[model samples]
Target: MNRIEFMTELAALLQDVPVEERREAMQYYNDYFDDAGDENEEQVISELGSPAKVAATIKADLGSQAGDYAEYSENGYTDSRFDQKEMPAGRAYQRKEEKEPPKTSRALKIVLIIAIILVGAPVLIPLGVGITLAVLGCVIALFCAFIALVVASVAVAIVGIVVFGVGIATLIPELAVGLALVGTGLILTVLGVIATVASVKLCLVVFPGICRGIVWICRRPFQGKAVA
Candidate 1:
């Protein structure tokens, strides 16, 4: 986006916001692109990502939930199980007043870890098999590289004789071609060796990425925050 278009879009957004808040938000956004002067509005917009996304993030940062005092009771003990019981008027208090552990504390972390190991261990077995296959592919690449090295060495020896009669410049092209092929073969060999090594340690190296990908794909259908 050019500067003009970026300013135009920002102007549109500011129309929906209160006057005081609008000025503050625009100044914050203007400073974001001060260093990128004379760039097209499209480029500037792309760099900033979506305007709505940025605004939402800023709004969330500025708006914090106040502490809830009514969710607790004057009594020290909190009955988390939520069984209904009549309480005296003076006993009821806000939950924020209770200085207690977070819902995701040490015990919950342990339980989640144990549950995942128990459930996911079975799923990881197939991933272990895939890594084994990748290792075999690497072995094949190494053998091909070994063959290229041998052929390249033989070619170099013959070119030495050819250079004597053909002159140094004439042999240079042939030497360059041979070297290029050898270099390509060596690079492939290295890649194959790395893949093999990675496969052997699939659980540590490959499984996490695969799991994250799957989770991301599965989550695509459910987005957008609930208004309530």
Candidate 2:
């Protein structure tokens, strides 16, 4: 119904109620009617049902002591005699409106706590493997380097020993010094390979976890709200 029609029906219904409650209910509804436009008012009134139905419900709810003398239709509605009849207003009508929250809203929360152990373990555990592989590579490389140094040292030592043997047979000290230099170079080269392999493995293992975290963060907004 239009605003005017709705007001007319409300006025009719409130006639039997006490004055204060009647006015309050009427005023509240009037304010509501003004706040909403034609489309909304129509929708609200439609939901509330016809004028007679609305009036009847309000009268009953207000606790009007309707008796057998009260006019009702075959289906217990006010019949023709109730039309335009004025009853008292200005009584208390306890109107309590309860508005329920939307059923589909989701609460803000922490969903998953990614276990750091699960992620870091895979990256760290393989460091041992990488270290072993690098060490093996370095050992092989250093062993070859060491062998070259040793052979070169030995050849020089023998030549020195022969040269000294020609000069008085006293070049043993020079041979010993050359062999010691060859051994030291082998140890340092092995360490470098071990460090290199570990670095490669750490970089590779952590990459996939970072990528997964990025994708999950991006999709958070689009996730559907929980229906409760």
Candidate 3:
């Protein structure tokens, strides 16, 4: 359907909603359409789906907020911190209350935290230390393994060169023995080259990726603290 027809239907469906909320929702969609330009009018309408669907979502959100407000009022706390704003289609309206916790509640939380710390300090401290040590040990082990692989690869290449020289010296004495040594040296050298390439790739790509993953995991808990 076209924008005007769609909006008309949406308005009719939202008649039961509060006046201010309805107006805000309407204005938000109107502005959205203006911003999108006439070229994308059909695309926007398609993305919004049916007007009845949009109205139902808004009504459901309002119902949930009403329930929350009712519960808040029943608790003998009154807040005049209501806020309404226009949003995108799926979230056409938002109502938020920016109320701080009561002083008593905040004090209670602090007391509870202190109590927990006092009771659990012995176990928590050791547990945290053990976890940290385990992670460090794993990282060290991986690094040592990488170093060992690189060293082994280089050692094999060096040994192959020495064996190849010995084979050349032995060639004059025994052709069969010299040929066998030469073949063995070539195989070892090829294997060493392959291992070295693999180690280089691990160092340049895989190891850094693993480190980044660990860092991301460590930061996850602190990332959204402001929102909390």
Q: Which structure among the candidates has the greatest TM-score? A: 3
Residues forming the 10-long window of minimal summed lDDT in candidate 3: 75-84
Model 3: per-residue Cα lDDT at residue 68: 51
lDDT of 1: 0.51
Model 3 lDDT tens row, 32-112: 676676777787787767898777766765675645532222222121222222223432222244598766777889999
Per-model TM-score versus the true fold: 0.24, 0.26, 0.52
lDDT of each: 0.51, 0.53, 0.73
Clashes per candidate, residues 3 or more apart or on different chains: 12, 9, 0
- Distance from true position, residue 83, model 3, in Å? 42
- List candidate 2 segments past 4 Å from native: 64-228
Q: Ranking under lDDT, best-scoring first?
A: 3, 2, 1
Best by lDDT: 3
